[model samples]
Target: MEITAKVPETSLKIKQKAIVIGGSIAGLLIARVLTDYFDQVTIVERDRFPDEPQPRSGVPQSHQLHVLLTQGYRTLNQLFPGLEEELASWDVYTLNWTADLKWLLPGGWSPHFPSELKTQSCSRNLLEFLIRKRLAAYSNLEFKETTIVTGLLLNPNRTAVEGVKLRHSNGTETQLTAQFIVDASGRNSQTPQWLKSLGYEPPQETIVNAFLGYSTRWYEYAGNEPLDYKALYLMPRAPHQSRGGVLYRVEGNRWIIGLIGVGKDYPPTDEVGFLEFARSLRNSEVYEAIKNAQPISPIYGYRRTENRLRHYEGLSRFPNNFVVVGDAVCVFNPVYGQGMTVAGLAALLLDQCFKQHTKSNSNPDLKNLGKQFQKKLALANKVPWLMATGEDLRWFTTEGEQPSVMTRFLQWYIEQVIFLASDQAEVYQAFMEVIHMTKPSTVFFRPSILLSVMRRMLSRHHKS
Candidate 1:
């Protein structure tokens, strides 16, 4: 499937131009969506994008493992048709969640069976490269590489954003005006400071840090041993278990192994300590699988795994014709693998908002669209925020806001669900769906699942 340049109907094209900050996955997807509503869309990236599929300086974590959840995969395919085929052509591994993943839960190993949750495994570099390549086909889309956004260009009243101030790599400064602007600049976004500089109050922020750290190393496939699963995950149980690991087969028949530690027990980057950390996981599968594999890259350590949400929607005053998306608005702990999927969902929501805005008004401008989109994006971000922070708060050493009574109750209930998932395929499938964002977390509260949880609790109670 090929995505052709979208020629928006004259009546629907409400904006003459739009600007997107950053050129990561979120920015790229947002720019793609903007092409439908704006005559021209430009992406300003701080780093000079590489010519091929390789790690760049801008995305420090690009070398780590990236899982494109089912919803993310579907959304990407919707945005850029034939994305899956293109990934397959690059030898990316495609596997069903349940059938191809060997997951070690807190209780035991989860049951493996065929299910609908199918997705691809690859390094972040490759995925971004393919998406950017697809995006290049649009004639109206433009990329300003090695350019940084200095600040927002606002109207005299400071109630609306007119464009952005740019600083090119050549030390030249210029301003690019647009009808609409979006900030998708990831976690290090300077939107808060920019707002402050404009004499506007920044959004309130909530931080939930588990102090989790991980080290990743790339490896070449060397073993001829047959395995039932293509990927392996050893999840850390809260309070006591602070170590975990994951081994995934990515493109080019290579494996990306990540060793995780919580509560400030940072994974070591040294050769000996990396393997030792893997050996400390709850299960030996990840360690056993990679102990003999030929390592191809040095161990890379990353520690910034906090879940942060800047409540932009709650702000009393926000500039019109401007909005925040992706990590700039809400960033999740990467351990949950929700970042990319949530960004994809945000882009889709932006598309829907544009359609609705154009359909309702005969001559629409981006007057109140930013506020509307921010509120809706906040609501959309709630579930994943809870999912990531809920898990992070389970650790006793976690900082920031403490869990509420409802959160504690849900955590306890979810632990039971995790136990049941080890043996019950139905429960596991539903759990996978919720985790993959295909269904709401409310699915766990449905009558059927609730009854199962009660029965399991009662059985365990009687046994105790």
Candidate 2:
């Protein structure tokens, strides 16, 4: 591990070393920010990372596809500029959400609107590989692979983390001392239970489940195969079956198809059934596109689609010097693809904390960092949660989150706005801006947006 100094803004010695558990994207980003305050940062992982761009044992969710949103890509590019170039070198596709690609929001199929917003995508393996390579060059950022974190080592007061106990691959045990510890271990993180053993209660949990499933296959686009895949979407109507699909170009000239469902409906993993599922969508373009293409892999399926959120920050006794990111804090419906974006927002919040502490006269609030970080982290979910969870509620016949009266009104209004926007440029752009995450949902409530909605409602074209 090689640690290099990029800048020296203050001579104030960093009294704290930091430890980050989890080698996933969330963990890596936390390590990136901790460099500003820690003399050294170590990442612990249970899976032995690959030497080349490949998959790991622990990150099974990576078997599916992942794309970095505008917010995530922007945050990462700012921290490690030139990353996109590096990813492109590995065949990652940089997609303009509106220009280079086609998208189907619940509102309607996305029109060819001029777009400044862009998202870069590739296989999860390639994305993580590039990030790992960048961080590996730093001597201060250490990687202890195939090691399991047994539990945290709390001080006598049991209020702050002093270090962590680890079990190596050979079954050897060791204590890793650190001034700050971040639990980026993801959805399966054990920090909550570990905290409970030390006399802390686990945080409250919120779940909005929509039993969704997807079957994916890697197809090499032969001649005439669409590289600029029109992003396809099919949202099921309420009191009826709700299903949707997404087909987009990923790295290595491969395309990924993610078909989602409400309740028990799902895309089949069998070869023939996969095709049937694609054809079952509202549009047949995706199904037709893959008809004669070569399939290099078997049809893959994953069904772990439940929205789980641990309100760790809401806990009355959140331990000092700890913060959780990624799936550990909140796991969203994969079909929505907000997990990576939300994780990026969490890392940016970490960056903000680092900047504030670096500029502060006193040491930043390490003990209260969890709480402060939670506040910022929660903001990341506010819009996405509303979007995905609220949408899920619409599919609820037997189970799902129950929407309030305001939610009911908003849903009806959103449907009209989206359908109307399908033809009205101003209405379409406003809805697009919010859906792509370029702007906040509050943008929908603006007086200008309201006028656009009203005018569209009054227009005859919209009625048609």
Candidate 3:
């Protein structure tokens, strides 16, 4: 393996151990961050990574389509400089969010225009492959693959995490000691249960399920036809129509077609049913794009689409030196395409907390580290959680807490804004910015956007 950068061992020396569970994107990133503060960072992964970009047992959704939002794209570059260029070398496509993509909103088709929100388009497998490869550069990092983390090891008083109990594939169990344990496990994480086993109360969970399900197929683009855009999204309308689909360019001149259904409407995995479901989408773009395309892979189905927030920050009593990140903390509805980006942000937050702790004291007290990081992570997750859950609530069949008056009002306002965005380029740009996480939600409340929304709402009301 090629060494990325040789760090002077004496420059950043600390006699500490940090263990990160799960070697997915989030875990790898956490390991990267820990290297600066810890003497050794071990990432325990359930599956050995593939030599190249391919699916693995741990990440079931590795075959699915994924895009890095503008913020995530930028953050990744900051973490691993020239990452975008490296992906390009591997044939990952970077498409303009608005100009090179077509969107079919409930109101109408979104107007095409140039915007700063450029999206990094590629398969989840390819992205993970690149991240893992980059992680190989750190001399202080180590990965113990094909190992399962059974539980956490706590101190004598059970006040702080001491390490983790690991079970090897050969059925042998052992303990690895660490000053800090970071859980980057995905949606099926067992952190809550592990915490409860140690006599600590588990974080309360908030689930909003739209019963969303999807079927995806990989296709090789037949160079015979000319394409109008690099990607396309046909959104599902709530209450009445619940079918949506997206077809986008990935690596190797191939495209991924995923058809989504909400409220228990599931896309079929069989070929005949899959094509029929794609054809039945509100817009014909996705179906048309894939109808004559060559399918390189079989249809795969995924159904765990609930937006689950494990409210770790709300827990009054929590163990020190143990913190959760990534989907282990919050799993959003995947159709919103926020998982990777949110994970990236959480890793950034963890890095900040570590830097702040190191700067303030020569020997920082690590007992309260977990609680402080959890609270900060919760604040970081607030906006994305609201955006995802609010949209999920639009469907009446969604299960979870009832929408508050404030939520309902904001939802109404956002729906109007979406309508205005469909026609106006400026409004669409602002909307894209908010969704891309580069701008705050308050951008939608700007005077220009608000006036247009009111004008459109009143005009429609008068017409009706």
Candidate 4:
């Protein structure tokens, strides 16, 4: 989608207003896009945002290691120009994923070469703070913090959402009306219950859980170590080696190390067990790098890693003038680092849908906009959802629908691609591109890659 496209003059003349629930990265991005098309945009957040780049009570995963994939970084730069420079001023490290990362795959170490897949390494707190700062500069935007959205306010026919009923921190209740409303609330969204209360059938849900968990700790970086790579990733081989870890260098001269475990082998919050978990990874690079690092923060544990998709698009009837985005509609396992990037893509999609609506209709109407957007958004989220769930299903402990034949074949093909990536720079770059969402999975289907994969498979088959 052309995110920088100019909003039609007709759109600006309309007295339209938009309200976004939750002040998350997705909500902030949606509000930024709505500012261009709507006369007013208000963000309703349950928690008061922090003045500085610090974790707030609303986002529990703020202290963990967060990665902005290549596409996500580019999308942010597009939305907020000079974002990279601003992050650089804050000491956020921008590194090429291929060259600056030491990634140990299931087979072995992946090949490292200079590539265009560069990403920002920073804490979630800092990224959200910077995005919110940028959004504050817009005159058409406003933030309603320390307020809870109690329920949806529907019109007389109850076919469209006219507004939201909000309860302030002081227990005062009020209704805020808007032409359009979006729910960007994270995994704990209550939109389903609200819809059911209004006599609407809730969307069907699909959940794939691997029972994965991770514990993270921050270490002060003195810049005296002889590390060649800027980041380290040790992936756990499924079904056997179920432990992994990552050491990411973020802003403020600090390293956020996350020790991960799958299949209900949750990482412990205590320091001793955290280190022991890291020490048990398939590779010791993460452990060795942080073994003697100066610790700066307590070990924080998180266990709600699951791939969930609320099939909002499949709903036969949805409220008009209302839509859902981000974790409210679908949430993926964070281990693949697809959440922020997918959210960015969804924001861009929202912008595109609005632009198209304005062009197609003489008097742009949002009567069925929610349904249209949800349908397109479901198509957009398919690849990432499949990618995350496919990987999780490799473990026997994962609970979800059984993998189909095509899914199993794709799994085997991807394993071959990863095995080839261990020794082939070209294959590694292609895999990284797909993983970063810069290229489609068809990249692996090219003649050269196909030949290499087939030859390797055939050779191993003959030997067996």
Q: Candidate 1's residue-wise lDDT over 224-300, tens digit each?
A: 99988888899999889999998889899999998889999998999998888888888888889888889999999
Better candidate number, 2 or 4, judged by TM-score: 4
* Candidate 2 local lDDT, residue 69: 70
lDDT winner, 1 or 2: 1
lDDT of each: 0.89, 0.75, 0.87, 0.89
lDDT of candidate 2 at residue 402, scale 0 to 100: 76
lDDT of 3 at 305: 88
Q: Whole-model lDDT, candidate 4?
A: 0.89
Q: Please, what are the lDDT tens digits per residue for candidate 3 over residues 1-464?
A: 34384544543445688999999988877777788778788999989889999999899988777777888887788777768878888776779998988899888998998878885788888888888888788888888999999999989988999999999999999999998899998888998999899888999999999999989999998878788889899999988799999988998999999899999999999999999999999978888888888999999999988999999999999999989999999999999888888888888888788777777565666788789999999998988988898999999899998779999899888888888888899899988898889999999999999999889988989999
Off by over 4 Å in 4: 1-13, 360-362
Residue 208's C-alpha lDDT in candidate 2? 81
Error of 4 at 99 (Å): 0.4
